[model samples]
Target chain A: MHVLIIGAAGMVGRKLLDRIAHEDGVLGGEVTRLTLVDVVEPTAPGPLDAITRSLALDLSDAGAAAQLIAERPDIIFHLAAIVSGEAEADFEKGYRVNLDGTRALFDAIRAEGLKEPYRPRVIFASSVAVFGAPFPEKIGDEFFTTPLTSYGTQKAIAELLLADYSRRGIFDGIGIRLPTICVRPGKPNKAASGFFSNILREPLAGQEAVLPVEEDVLHWFASPRSAAGFFVHAATLDLEKVGLRRNLTMPGLSATVRDEIAALERVAGAKAVRLIRREPDETIRRIVAGWPRDFDARRAAELGFKAETRFDDIIRAHIEDELGGKI
Target chain B: MHVLIIGAAGMVGRKLLDRIAHEDGVLGGEVTRLTLVDVVEPTAPGPLDAITRSLALDLSDAGAAAQLIAERPDIIFHLAAIVSGEAEADFEKGYRVNLDGTRALFDAIRAEGLKEPYRPRVIFASSVAVFGAPFPEKIGDEFFTTPLTSYGTQKAIAELLLADYSRRGIFDGIGIRLPTICVRPGKPNKAASGFFSNILREPLAGQEAVLPVEEDVLHWFASPRSAAGFFVHAATLDLEKVGLRRNLTMPGLSATVRDEIAALERVAGAKAVRLIRREPDETIRRIVAGWPRDFDARRAAELGFKAETRFDDIIRAHIEDELGGKI
Candidate 1:
């Protein structure tokens, strides 16, 4: 069996590569080749025995998506996207990369069926950003998407198209709206939701980090490892069981900033918590205020998807995966 | 106050003209002029006395929308659409007219503000076909749109664009998703849902009509008068009360075919009920089966929008408004 991963240079994509490399055989089948695609060439990561291929190509270009899909890989993990900040700032680029790129891939797969019978499993990484303001205490499987940003709008539209095309028998597709990955590895960043992870990850490594919002601000989260796991599960699951509705909101942990600090103190002692600063940025506060803090994952859970039960487990998992089991 | 009505040659458009003319004043203000636009030259509905003007132009043509908005009408009624049957049968034309036409009008409005401050109340006619298969007991303000057909997709996308543009302060807009108009005045047509109205309407007019589905299959409905009223109410609404969320599901009556036939029997005796031919057509059944049966329209009701309370009232409304209470 072979697998293709798009956006292979991103954080979760890299983690997914590592997991699949170790597993060797996936879903009771021998994994022979892995195809990695991104705008920038993806590094092979480790030794390969003549079966791994890496390519750099723009997915949104007219013939690029068709060229990539013509190889007829059995499974495809589509994880490419322009991030929220960039998308909000640059409208044309956002629509081109996020909307056009995604649509082109789907159309390519559809056009392939004319030559012969072809139905590859496609697992798409969507986001909770699809749900906007005036949310319920726990958003249910039936919630409408009234996205407030261009990025969210693009994702919602993609979800609609994916479902429609899948119903039309183009491919077996699944879209999972991931929660924000907590304890995101690397230096502090500018995403308004960054502090949810920054306040802990930076302090745990003995570095000072800025706190941009009030400690009571609540948000949803999943670990990077869990996000990778969701893609694998979606890629191998019986899509017939998912029925005509192919999109699901992945399970996540809802935690407040105070909750993060409390969990950090429990794991690495109170000294780690003291490295945080207490300046509140109003812009970040206003943006964070509108995000959903919880979801009712009834449909996802029934289909065997899982996530960390506690915030402590989430931080621990990130440290173990990125820092090699030691903090 | 001046008003512009696009697609002014269509059924509801002509009815709106007659109503507005009879009312003399619209939105509690004296009307100075009305611009009626359509591809086919609309014959003047009644004696205008120098208060009305007509223009024939394809709204989707380049520069047409901007030129229309430059006239700076106080309110704009957008009633243009390629109907469901045409939209589904011809994909390219469906998208060109429904999607591109709506976007051009919105972009035109936005461009006007770049030169000078201009805002118009835009009342758009959307449809309940936006909600498709696998329905819940009562679709509420927060139900996902999984449209089963191309026409539904176009309307749903338009609703998103309308909300986003309104949020950006481009225009004060509201989209009303009207229910299937019942007891429609005309010959029996090709529309799948046409049977819902035809079964009773043709019978009352002493013509034979087909019953295409099981008697227990329920569906939602509104009278043509109620639909026209919804457009007027949306135009005068204080959009600040609606804010950035611009699309609303209009109120309607939910009844099964048996309920409809029962009402017909009550209004015109056993003779009208007997006029409905009990011939089940599989094609119409398949189409009608995918439609939504009911809606929880709390938002529209709170905004003072209303509909006929029962099927009996709906039948009575059809007779009173279209047939002068003669049945």
Candidate 2:
């Protein structure tokens, strides 16, 4: 099967590519052709024994999305987006890239369908930020999307467009609202929620990291491997089972800061847990206070999507996948 | 206060015009200027002592929204839309009018705000069609908007845009999700829900009207007068009280077909009720089945937006308002 991956250079996208290269026969067929795209030229994951092409394109630019859709890959994965802090700070850029860019792609797909009987499976990487604060103990499948930031609002709007386009038979589409990727690889960046991964990742690598929030503050997570697994499952699943609601919240592990310390202690050593320094940042605390901590993703679970149920499992997966299975 | 009405020729819009003219000092200030617009020429609802202008302009046309916003009416009422049946049949036109037109107006407001400090009160005419099936007995303010039709999806998207723009301080906006306007004035149109009014409206005027659905079919409703009142209340209500959820399901009476028939008998005797004919329409029945039957509009009610609580009261409102206090 031919496949196209947007934002293919990002961590999860790269991991997904690596999985495809190894599995070969996954996605319900053999991987015969690949079209990888990103804002910057994305290098092929590894040796490709099939037809392959790479393009650096901005979807928000006029005619760019149409050019991409014209290729008509059998399956397409869209993962490009501006992060939360940038979106909140720069409103115009956020709407231009996140909202307008996404809509342009969907509209391009619909226009393509007008030419012939062409329908491709589209997998969008959505985020749990679609749900804001003042939530219930466990946000259910039917919970409303009331995003507090510009990024979440953009995702929620794109999710609506995805459902509408799918209903109109333009494309077979699905939006996976991914949980926060715990133990995110690479150095910590500017995302407010980056600390959730930082404290565990740095300490596990024998580097001291600041614990910005209290240990009792709970949040949801899934490892990068589990995140990739969700895309694989979504691409192959029977869309008839998904029904009219095309967007779904992927199942994730709900844990607290203390849970991370416990898991790190179990995986590495007591010395690793002691590397976390307690520090209180009021702005970060206020922002984190408005985030969703738990979700009842029964629909996704019943549909055979799985994620790490324990924080320790998440740490183990990170170690096995990124750390050569050693401390 | 200067006021602008986007669909001033429609049922609720005309009533609103009449209300403003008669109330004299409605909208918390004396009526000073009126700018009325519709796709066709809109007739003056009543004598206007204040300066008024009427125009025949489609909002989707380039520069039309900008021209309207340039005048900068202190309070703007946006009631223009392609009805549900038309929007479902013509997808392109639906998005062009319902989605693009709405966004064009919002962008115009944002641009106006950029030029100077000008933020107008924008009251949008949304619909309960934003809610799909599989709902609880009484849909709440927090219910997710998963529209079953193109029209509903467009309205839901507009509601999201309204909230985001309000949060950004570009404009003060409120979206009122109107229920089916029972006893709607004039001839029956193609709206699937039109029969809910036809069965009562025609029969009350001593004419035969068909009932397309079962007597047990329950639905939510408010009179055209009540719908106009929702806009009036929305125009001046303190924005702080509304908080962040800018869209509201307006309060309306929930009753079955039988309840409407009984109300007609009590208000105008069986002679009027006898004019009703039963002719089940399979298409309309299937469509109506997916609609919301009731809503728990507690927030709207708490904010002092009132509507008839019983079918008898709704019928009386029609008679008193439309029939000039006579049956």
Candidate 3:
């Protein structure tokens, strides 16, 4: 089987690449080649014999998507997107890249007609940002998407297109609405939600971190490792069971900022909790306020997708993965 | 006030034009001009004193929408669409004309800026098709849009775009989700739902009619007169009262086929029911099966959008408006 990953340069994309590189053998069968494509060329995921090609080109470019679809990989992972902050700030660029770019890719595949007998698996990385404020007790699978930001709206639109295209039999597709990845690796990014992970990761490594929102602020999460696992599971699953509604909200653990602090204390120490400095930023607060604190990912769970049960385990997993078990 | 009507040649559009033309100096508090656009040139409504301009061009054409936006009318009524059955049959054209065309019009308006605090009222004609199967007893303001057809998907997307543009202060936009218009005047069209009107309409007019579905197949509806009223209300609404959610489900009467027949009997006597032939068609059954049966249009009613409380009243109103109160 050959697999192609779009946005293969992003953090979760790299992890997905690493997983596929190491686990070349499939669930009861054989795995052969892996192809990675992004706006920027992706770094090679070691020297796995099963891996073959890597390319860098903007997928949104008019003819570029058609070219990519021509390769006809067995599975395609579309993870490319302009982030929430960037999409909100640059409206035209955001709609162009997020909406038009995504639609172009879908159109390219449809125009190609799945090459007769075989149809590729298309896995889309959607986000929880699709849900907005005035959320219910736990956002059920049936909840309507009234996205507060342009990024969320774009994803919601993409989800609809994916379902429609899949129904047309262009490709067997699944959209996974991933919770924000907690303890996100590398330096603290500019994403408003970055503080959720930053406060935990920084404090665990004995570095001071800013707490822009109140400790009582609640949010949903999954770790980087679990997110990759969810995608892999989604790609390999039997899609006939998914029916016409191919999109599902991936399972996640709902935690409060104070719960995160407690988890840090549990995994690291009280000294680490103390390292979190409270400096409330209204901009971050307003942004975070619009997000869903929890979701009832019943569909995803029923489909055999999994996530970390405990926030402490999520933090400890990050420490084990990034710091070589030093924490 | 200058009013621009897209799809002005359509059935409902023509009725709206006639209503507006006749009430020129009344409801509008004096009108100055009317810009009518459709793929085919719309006939002028009588010999009106107001400046009436008719243009025959596809609004989806690259430059056409922008050019229309440049006119910057006081009220823009966008009633154009490829209907459900046709849209489902031709997916690409449905999306291009319905979705892309709508977006182009919106983008053009936003590009023109506020033009010194003047933003034209954009009233979009959305459809009840936005809601699909596994419907509630009564769909409310917050029901999720899980459209069963491509036409519904297009309308749902357009509704989102309208809300977003309105939020950005580019235009004062409103989308009215019209229920299936019953007792439609003129010959029966190709719409699967056409039977809903045809069954009652033809019988009442002493013509043969076919009842394709079982009597218990309930559906939502508003008369043509009510739909015209909805457009007028949507155009003049103080949108600030609508807040960020610009789309609204218009008020309608919900009844089963049996109820419709009973109403027809009560209004036009048993002789009208005698004209109905019971011949079920599988194709029509499959299509109508997915339609929404009812809606709790509380928000629309609170905003003064009225509809018939009884099915007989709806049929009688249609007769009164279209056939001089004689059936």
lDDT of each: 0.84, 0.90, 0.85
Clashing pairs in 2: none
Q: Could you give candidate 1's per-residue lDDT for residues B1-327 as a string of tens digits?
A: 878889888877876776787775645577788888888877555655478888898778898898888888888888888888898777657767887788889888888877899888888988887887788889897898878777887888788778867776778889999998987877888888889989888888888888979999999999888887888788777888886678899999999999999999999999888888889888888878889999998899888899988999888888987788996
True contacts kept of 2: 0.53
Task: Supply candidate 1's per-residue lDDT for B145.
Answer: 81
Say which docking band candidate 1 falls in: medium
User: Model 1 segments beyond 4 Å from truth?
Assistant: A1-4, A27-35, A47-58, A70-73, A114-117, B1-6, B27-44, B48-74
lDDT of 3: 0.85
Could you give the interface RMSD of each candidate, to one decimal?
A: 1.3, 0.9, 1.2
**DockQ values of all predictions:** 0.54, 0.73, 0.61
- N/CA/C clash count, model 3: 0
> How much is the TM-score of the A chain of model 3?
0.96
Instruction: For residues B271-326, write the lDDT of model 2, one tens digit per residue.
Output: 98899888989998998889999999999999999998888888888888888888
Give the DockQ-based CAPRI class for model 3: medium
**Number of clashes in every candidate structure?**
0, 0, 0
Return the lDDT, model 1, position A220: 84
RMSD of every candidate to native, in Å, equals: 2.8, 1.2, 1.8
* lDDT of model 3, residue A61: 82
User: What are the per-residue Cα lDDT tens digits for candidate 2 across A1-327?
Assistant: 789898888988988888888886678898788988899988785566346798898889999889988988889999999888899899889999998999888888888888977899999999998887789999998888878888998998888888888888889999999999988999987778989999988988889988888999999999999999999999999999999898999999999998988888888889998898989988899899999999999999999999999888999998999899988
